[model samples]
Target chain A: MAEEIEISISPTGQVTVRTIGIKGPKCVQAAEAVAKIIGQIESRELTSEYYEAEGHVSGQIEVRGRR
Target chain B: MSSVILVTPLIIANWSVISAAVLGACGAMGFTVASGAVSGSGRARSGSSVTRAEIEVENSEVLAGGGGTDEEMVVEKDGVRATFSRDARGALKVCMEGTGYSKGQLKQIGQELMEQVTQQYVYHRVVTELKERGMPIVHEEVEADRTVKIRVRNW
Candidate 1:
């Protein structure tokens, strides 16, 4: 999947940045890069996807049996 | 799918970058740069009949050098004149004046101009930094309410 960064700037000068297609700590890093350029980060929220392991698919569970 | 960040913009840039944003804002608001000198005729004509209003760009710091000095950029449109300068503390200050307009009107114009300056500043900073980091903008748009939305793809 292609990694993407989405940025929204309100008319009042507030900025909101979100990272798409990037998972784990790298996503935070991407967002931080943007924040550093613009200004100070007031708040940050990590989505559930951030906790997902890299390259891991959602709702997929593997069963292991003793061999 | 990772994180969302809310930011308050701080304009800490050299004169050229800040001037670029000022020009962008002026163009968007139908104002034209009148002079590059602080002593230029861009000021509101001095008279008892003129009303004046000043506004400060929040969280901003305009640096000197890079073709910038202790000068101000003046812009004018429709009998209204605005001067952009850095205050003693280095924050960006906008002083607006016009003969026929009231203080409220001038304030409104100054407020709008400041907002536009901020938007333009953020736009330039984000786009430039992203490009430097190898994430070029894939899509850009201005919404109906003047909000700017930018999307960049990381390869």
Candidate 2:
């Protein structure tokens, strides 16, 4: 999936950076540059998607017949 | 559903950095850098307050370290003039002065310029950081409201 970052600045000069299609710690890493640039990270909230495991999960089966 | 980060920008930029941002914003907004040496011998006077708005950017190092030389700059577009100077507190301030626009209009312009400066600053900062981290930029654009949006991908 392609990652998307949306930065919105209000007329009053407030900036909000939202990251979509990325998960886990990577999202924070992606947005940190903006936070560092702007000033400080006022508040950060993680959605349920963030807690989900990263990447795809594949199953592997091991079969043993008479060893 | 990925993640959302709300940032309240506290400008801690230096005079040099601010000047760069200001110049970029002025260029983008079609404003020309006017000489700060504009004499006070103008012919007419406007009833409206010349100081439309002011933004203070603090530099803590200047206070702790040795005293630094003051910085001042001026730019204008049409009758709108923006003056950037170092205040008594050693913080940089941008004051909007002019008569062509009303108080509300001047405030709007000042705020917009401030936002542009900030957005450009962040764009440069983030792009540099991404490049340093070896992240490839997928796309970048300045939105209608002058907000800079940059998309970088990790391979």
Candidate 3:
């Protein structure tokens, strides 16, 4: 799947950046740069999809039970 | 929603340094500067019971380097005139004067302008960071909702 980043800005100046279709650490890394520029990260919640194996990571079938 | 990171922007700066961003926002929002430019502290409107709104820029800096003891920018449009300046605490402050608009209406307008200034400012900063990291932009658009969407990827 193609990687995509979607950013939404609220009427009150809060910003939400979501990463889609990326795997493992790459997902967080992809969103981090943009996040840093937007403002202070008031809160963050990682989705279950975050634990999936990174598509580009070689020979890795990483997965973890829901926490 | 769990994959989302929420950020609250704190914008602060000296009026001199942020003049360009302010001007960019003004132009985008259909505001025009009556005078070319002015230095030191000044008010655009006098003796008006205009609604006042203030937005404090968090983690922002004065681009002018020198102290912002005396710097201001005035922008006007039809019924509105706005003054941008830095407070003693170094936070950028905007005051708007509009005769016909209600207090709530003026506050809403002020907030919208702040958002535009912020979005425009962050756009340049983010694009530069992307270029530095060698992540070329794949797609970008200003959605109908006025939200900017930018997609970048590493080749």
Once fitted onto the true fold, the runs of candidate 1 whose alpha carbons sit more than 4 angstroms away are: A58-67, B39-44
TM-scores of the candidates, chain A only: 0.78, 0.73, 0.73
- What tens-digit string does per-residue lDDT give for candidate 3 at B31-81? 988665556655545556665556555566555565344576777787877
The candidate scoring highest on lDDT is 1
Cα lDDT of model 2 by residue, A1-67, tens digit: 7876666665445677777787888887767765666667777878876787779889999998996
| Model 3 DockQ, alpha carbons vs. true complex | 0.39
Residue pair clashes in candidate 3: B10-B58, B11-B57, B11-B58, B12-B57
* Clash pairs detected, candidate 2: none
Clashing pairs in 1: none
The order of the candidates by lDDT, greatest first, is 1, 3, 2
| CAPRI grade of model 3 | acceptable
Instruction: Write candidate 3's Cα lDDT for A1-67 as tens digits.
Output: 7777766654335677788787677777756656886667877768866888765655768799998
In model 3, where do residues sit more than 4 Å from their true spots? Answer: A2-12, A55-67, B12-17, B48-69
Model 3 lDDT vs. the true structure?
0.69
CA-lDDT, candidates in order: 0.86, 0.67, 0.69
Best model number under DockQ: 1
